[model samples]
Target: MTTPASSPSPSSSASATPPPGIPDPAAPPAVAGDRITQDRPVPLLRVCHFELVKVVSQWRTRLLLLACWIAPGLFVAAVSQQSTLPTDTLFGRWMLATGWAGPLVVLGFAGIWALPLLTSVVAGDVFAAEDRLGTWRHLLVAVRSPRRIFAAKALASLVVILLLVVGLAGSSTVGGLVAVGHRPLIGLDGHLLAPGDAAGRVLLAWLCVLAPTLALAATGLLGSVALGRSPMGLLLPALVALAMQLAQMLPLPVGVRLALPGYAFISWNGLFTGPAQVGPLLIGVVVGLVWATAATALAYALFLRRDFTNPTDGVPGRRAVTVGVLPLAALLAVMVVTVRTATGATGSGIDQEKVQRSVATAFAHLYRVQTGQLNRPDVTEAQLKATAACDKGGSTADPEGSGNDWRCVVSWHLPGVEAAGTALYQLDVTTDGRFVADGDGPKEVNGYFLVRTPTGDAPNPLWQFDGNVELLPATPKG
Candidate 1:
């Protein structure tokens, strides 16, 4: 030939080697049955599967799952060996009374710390780790579509969190049952739930918490995308959780507190009550959905627009903070205002009638349990006909607000007794529609801190009781 064959052009050279997930159009055709060699786009599910495999292959993920499975066992054993129970927890005081309490107590503790930390560890690192490793470009080259990649990673992170929750719940429940022995659990409404019923409730309670847990995970995902650093991503959700906890303790309006994502963590408390309240559950679901939706959408937007041209892009620390904080703050403020407007002031949540009704219902249930404990004839709640009148604080203080100072006088008709019995209770009411009533007893009926049962001395269900009133707008009577 007159001239040597022209060297392959740079564009042609690049075209010869297509990215991993993308197929080569110039390749020879494969056999009809060989679909693997065909030129086609990768499916979203396949991408998600690859991401999940990548996550599960990591050592930290394996360690996390193992810890989730083992930690609850250790907690149950430790509490069993101790002289003191974790009375501050929702079911902690009943540790010795029923084995089921172990799972519930562990659940309470997990909501406050364990779940958020565990969720963040995976979600927070998922995307940022690639950035840290200078592999984001490589990932982009493989997948070609950032939206598909984001969806896969987000779905994979959710699967990981879901696995963790299942492991923790199963471990705590099975371990508690095996170690502590199955016994009736004292319901939050001052009644006893059989072992089988408590088990169902406990599992359901764990399932209920998944909403907030996932919302927290989505938040971590947002942090991962914005910060582009694993550590910052890991800490963001945890910091947010800490802030929410502090805010919950403050004198915030009922609706405002209900709208916060953290409220979902403790919303399962209503499930343990005799007449299970679903209002808090509904609020928790709504709040969780709002948070998850906002965080995930923001993260998706950030991921799509991220500059993959520079692998070593300097961390946009200040910009990330602005991008992350402002939107979230605006969303929260809007939610708070809307909820407050819809539900009125905090005072509307805890009124005299609601408190009185709640107290009476709790007392009636506990009195039935007391009679059963003393081997007295059985009495139905209808026969008891309980009634209560509660006064919050002295005349000098504002009558409408929630405070530690409240007195309730409860009266109920007791079976096989000529006259109705009366009991006084000192109540500490909170802004979030919860109260603790310490019975000022007639000793014989209310019993002391410990009541005599057929088996042995047990914590009196009537001595000190916790109650909640739904803070939603009152439904019209039929």
Candidate 2:
């Protein structure tokens, strides 16, 4: 039998014809679709848009976008009511940017249903949605390639997540500015922040705040693809986010904490402080990207390789997921160490006792007969409160390294100096081996320290009380 006429590529046109049973030489060749791109690489963005269109057109996606808008507005309003401080004040500003976007806000708003649910809803279903609806197999036939389709779907899901985050941040900021008023807020170290800095910080707080959440969404996408259940896609990511939160709170080592996305959540508190530290945040961003990418990759590999044997029950690769295990185990070890450290930290009040002894020892010299009159150490309530913060820090126990904070009330009996509430001198020594002296601090009518009554929880209007410093020691020869 004579073979069918062979077709030649356009590039091969003008070449001599082959003998019979070979492809035709003169006749225009049939179109080879694969060679269409032989001239140049197809733009990746084109593929990206193709996928984005698929995701955005879905009704659930539209509803998710709507929810992203409403969630932040309602949350900001509720916080505005409970807060006594004007949202513009130092504390209020802090609350608006970080405190609101933090885990506390997540807990209060998302409750049992975390926002990761929505992320999973989009990410998990972005691919499987097609398969679940029976459109995937048909589309695969048209695309003729599994890899390109996978990439497009993943990019589309990522774009959707980013859109959700941007929407939430924009709405929350506008809502917060309206609800709380734009005012300078305080830094984590109780320092004041300016209006410009506050605005910059609010933006950073929102942008950086959503990194881990997006990671959660990415992971949810993996679960969604594997399970093919629309609901499980949402729940799995939330559970994972919750687990990460627990890992962060377990008092793990700084290094281990650095790896956790949740640890990065509180980095926004540093915006107002003099020094900027986004170490944990950066780590979180890296780990988040890694986990998100890995999960999506593995899920795609499994889904693409497997047949439609069991739609409901996904078949995971036999290779176990040890990627998350190392960090998690390390985190758990660090947690145990941290608990031990904490328990041990409380008992060693050496620094605290040193403070008490220093005060007692220094003032004891003042009571000697040679001086004729006792010069008691003068400490204002403000000084005392500022110094004793470590002691009063939500408990009676001291923190690591004697809590790295110490203050004492230096008081002594004086013959002429009024004992009412005046301080002659003030010394402020911090536990980190530094001192804060307020020589220019307010003094009284009798040349003693003038104390200000701290307002609003003043912690007893206590300033900082430091041990006495001797200008001169009595000399026997003199």
Candidate 3:
């Protein structure tokens, strides 16, 4: 050391103790710039793929899918063995006679609760499972972004719902075709549809329900995120659906009823009629998409803001409460105001021109249907030459109010009768727009009863009286 510690060689000097803040020169010499390169966020498709794999691997999911695939066949078999057709539901009267009607029966049952329940099983559990398994931390760390994770989970749930719907529709179609032959189908308009056309319409009707089903899945996902991973998350959405359905059955205002989810579920009925109306179907699609978008946004925002490090933070806080309560309160206030307005305006009066036109159209259709049932090809709308004039309590001042004392004078000519006869109709109009009429006409027409002779003995033809009729609003003729 004294011998000039021989100014250390260049190599030895470079390897000597380094400055305190500087990195070691020989330790693979630190890179010139930032030592850690930031990795790009995981792709959404990859995340969704992972979620799909997770879902398909679970025994619960597999079991539910299996049930969905088999239940329709079992239902068709059981229904085929029954002696009576279920006539309460729309299109149910023909369920046992035609393959196309079978799907309608299944759809009617599914709309009650089965579809929602099936959708919720996976949607409610997708997000909650992470928290239940104490793996949120791991998932967050692995995915590195909560938004992407939520998107992946939601997409997976939607995919699962689609699969379920397809399975149900296909299975029902196959089972129905096997159990009941693909004969001509009777439409809502009382017209006959060929077998091929009937199959197409049935398939379209089944596809129309996809919108509402996706909305339900979104609702379940929101519940899972807000309520945490639990059974409540699974049950609350179904309860909400049930409550909505009940609300639809109430005497609510038209606006409010149209806004409910239950209305969307049955919108597919429009597809089965001639001159198909797409308005309700489009509205349903809009409502479903809005609900799904709003729920997805809320879930994503809440998940991003949530702090999983603190257990107490997992519960919905003031912001969540405010987010939920404000909209509900607003909706409730609107509903209350609408219902009150509708109830108080019962005496607002009706439009004479509208009622007159409606009555005329209704009478024509009623006459045609009645005569057709008796196999009377000679009795036609043109031959009857019907004309109706309606009055409310014999005054034109207020023609459109709820009353039991409305009257219509209808004039028509019977075949081979030279003179036109006038019939007096006593009408009772309800607030819900139904018409109950009792007619007093010539003794020959008033006392006559039409007997329909059935082509087959199994289902006896129904009989009709000539002078009484119940009619719905003119807007929906069927």
Candidate 4:
């Protein structure tokens, strides 16, 4: 018999009509071993390494790093050749006198602009460059997660920033030491520092800038992820830095100023003084960390939600406004509230301690300079035996009140006079630390005057009337 045509084998029938969810043996495999291996998630460390390699391999990155390595040396060389000191900056007046001052000057300049620009070289381009090259898709595919890719790029940028900052600090320190001799540093407190101690303080000062620098890098990265254009990314962060610098110059409330990044940049000045005060430095650290954290988080969110497939699908306007305007508004509101609340709590009076310290320091420096002009090496600040008791508006209870009326009874011995004389000062002091005073002392010191020199090339000098003839009734010392 036809043998029932040997009904198609069950295996053949099953192959022809495979059950649901089962692979067709007759068809090519759905996934090859090579593809399975290729599709495996990349380790985070490996991704970070790849990004770092990609960044380091770029010619521009190499060039920028080279610039960072050499710029400080060139700057120091140029500054060393100058005859006039840059008295406008901290430690600038003493830069020519000691190598220790060189780092301070360089740090001041870097804080103003250089650090931001240098950091932006990598940070501003790290994320935007991928978009410019149409390589985001490839990077995402390899990393398997957008967050991982963003993190890798951001970490790479941060690494570059750290390297650049270290390079700048090292180069500047070495250049300063070489160009200017490593002599004892004269501190802001007018005390001398040993060479080793000075070097250590200078290094510490440089290290203090690390937080602000990282904040700037994070800001640049945020701009890169948000703006998506290399030039805009670079320009925005630099502009923000510049704006903050300008804001620091404004007469804003202390709380508002402390919130600014520019204030953090100069906080290292405390390290150069005797009995270093770390309050501002700590505040800077907190501000920097907050900024870096917020910017990085926002950047990661923006990058994650970005539509790489549709390049024209611009960032949503609401999202942009929320990201850009809301935070700024909140900061401003907080600042206003802080200022208002603080204003009500603060007494309308001068800080007697601050005033005393300022006056003492100012008088000492002035006396020292005046004596130097007269070639009186014997008349030292200590030998003057200057002591003062200050009173504001005839009341010690409200020393914080703002006014032009202040008085101080100062006792000091003049250069050639054996007997110590007492003087009463009719002082006009401003809240901004400016003072104009007329002093009355014993008749023996009528013509004795102190010459006040103005900074820069101005030849005009004023003779300060340090001694007056009339003595006032003694008031109770506060």
Candidate 5:
């Protein structure tokens, strides 16, 4: 140039270079993309929506929803076709009498088996799919916030679980109503439930199950992130549920059993009872929250510290081991403390006076039902004057604690019928104060195992029954 080139205009200079911290667009694509990810902050809601949409759009998810919606109808049809009722299940015998019982029967089945597995089907695959697709690095790059990603995924899983639960409940209810006629239902206490009341209670029972289902879903989500493999993630929560269920069969302390995650699934039985057992319901709510929160927190921490720099790398470093092991160890410590506390509070785990009271009450209600079936005149509980004398394992064993050797002698009288007698019942009492009482009957009073009714043959109300003893301080009968 003749002298010095004219200084570049301020506008041109500004356009040529980004600000001091910002990477220039003209830089290499990888470097520029990295800078953009670091600088950008995606809204949490937007991420959640995206994740949810992704989850729902999957073919597997759609199939699962469809199955949940249609399977119950098929079940009802199959049950209706069968001559013999599925009396072993809680509400199985009532399917023919009332359509409402179909849902309850299905509910009992799903609570034990379907809930954990169905909840896991998607939740377990959510993160593992990313690993399978080698997209963890890409996801991290796009979001740049593991915390936000975890939240979005967890929320998405829970929402999917909710949809599944609702689908099953609604489908079963509608199927039962449409296929079977809406007749009065037999309540757990052997009393008659109006059609409307039965429907309401059935729906409420399904609703009560949501808490535990969600907790199981969270466990699946954690497994997905930790295992980072689709099949393992899918199976871990289900296996855990199976283990928890098996644990329930053990002679664990009542408090410890109640505290277990699986207990929450069956705790909804409290809803069908006359007084509505609030203790189990409250315990379920607390247990579900604790498990879900703990699992999710551990998952979040692990995800945050995960090394996705080398997308295919699987060998965990010492720090990764430390990060994973420390939280699990802490969780174990807390669990140990909780178990000790619960064990200390459990005391003898059975109260004779409470057992007697519950047995007598249950017998009175059920006997009333039996009378109606026999076409006999109605009898009042006061008139029956039901009383029960209960003992734990005979004179040799601890007679005040839980055991299968418990026995109860219940005596009651029928109004206007002269011959009334006492019946002996062998009880299998659990640590939780619930029992299955097998009756040694004066056949005339307690009746046979099955009794004929207008609808069909049904289980006798008095032959064998379930009852619960309240875990309260025993007081002498007045």
Candidate 6:
């Protein structure tokens, strides 16, 4: 009995003096309902995998992936079949005619709507579908916490977006290059767009197209987590975008267009053109980051607090879609009506004979002074003066306009050359009354038919002189 008192068996000793403050090994294991275990969910690859599986399980995401392929192909085909003129500048040179080739190839084919919307469909759905499908409860048990689940979902979503973007860029670029003739690209402003430099810029421009759309996608995520319908998030961001575009297009004060997502993303023009404007470009990028980050953060928080078990369960609402679409439809309708009103002028078609006569007269006078063909007319004194007088009263595309709706300021002074023929003409002569450059080299003649000097290579001293500056209208009008 004394011996037994000296040494209680191991089990008796353990039970009598509870294990020093540590959790007793003998206690029942924790489950979801248990307080300590309930509070903490251990991070695990299994959790990440579980969320990823859920994302891929949805069929809509797969359909979007399919769209990613089909859209660019259709665009390239349309560009090839429909286009008709070279844009003239190196960047846009062939864009007017060819959809795939040259610098404008990206713009002409991918265009304004397709790529942006394709990105939106996939990006907009990432987290939104989770709420749409009523699957947050299933997600909760697999992942330790909602935040971690949201993070995995977002990362997976981004990977999907990036994959789609890559598909779009590669397919479009190839399709455009193949379908439209790939000549050197010219810009809308007619700048020489080098091909090697331009290819990279265009690829980047396609990438930058992602800029404004990310916020749309991020906002979608927020709506998914908060509203249980991803579409709610889709509405406000698109509305913000729509409102900004309207404000920008308005004949407003400075900084107006800067607010719009579409306007901010307009810097892709610079990438295609010779001189890219980085101010708008950088602003858009920064703003895009802010928009995406804020929405994502909000989604994270909402998702964290959401009662996914019951869902904000109700019939999914479509007000946001109506809100998104109606304004845009109205805008398009207004634009169509306005365009018809402005263009449906009560007038006969343009008169070519009168225009030809005027252009011929101007050419004769200017060429005589520059070439000393008429021993320098007393009125056509200096370079500027001769160009001015010759360009004045030029015939226009309009049948009724007294002066040419568009004018020309033709000159050629190669950076190093000190010659009369080496001039680059700035022809501010479009039907729209906008400026358009004509020749980038030398002018063989003035405005009408005449041949002078050529550079680089030529047959003879006469026809070789072919750096003439002529502003062709939308249609070569009167």
Would you list the C-alpha lDDT of every candidate in the order shown?
A: 0.80, 0.49, 0.65, 0.65, 0.74, 0.47
lDDT of 1: 0.80
Clashes of 6: 24
Return the TM-score for each candidate structure. Answer: 0.85, 0.58, 0.70, 0.70, 0.81, 0.57
The top-ranked prediction according to TM-score is: 1
Residues 287-308, model 2: lDDT tens digits: 6565555566666675576465
Sliding window of 10 residues with minimal summed lDDT for model 3: 461-470
Scored by lDDT, model 2 comes in at 0.49
How many clashing pairs in candidate 4? 5
Error of 6 at 406 (Å): 8.0
Please report the candidate that would top lDDT against the real structure.
Answer: 1
Using lDDT as the measure, name the better of candidate 2 and candidate 3. Answer: 3
Candidate 5, RMSD to the unseen true structure: 6.3
Per-residue accuracy of model 3 over 1-478 as CA lDDT, tens digit each: 4665556789887668675544454656435487743435688999999999998889988987887788887787568657776755566666676877777788878877778888778887888888778898777766777888988998898888788877788787777888888887765443457899999888887776776777677778877887775577777568777887777555555445445544557666656545554555555565666666666666777777778998766565566556543654454465445433433322222445545554554455556554555456656657778777878877544676546677777677789989986766666654323344555554333323233335422231111111111112224322
Q: Please, what are the lDDT tens digits per residue for candidate 4 over residues 138-240?
A: 7765577787788888888888877877777778777777888888775654455889999998888887788778777888887788777547777766787
lDDT of candidate 6 over 372-408, digit per residue (tens): 4323333332332222212434453333322324233
The sequence of per-residue lDDT tens digits that candidate 1 reaches over residues 233-344 is: 8888898888888977777667778889878787788887767877777678777888888889888887777878965452656656666778888888887776677556
Better lDDT candidate (3, 5): 5
Off by over 4 Å in 2: 1-47, 74-114, 308-398, 401-478
Which of the two, 1 or 6, has more lDDT?
A: 1
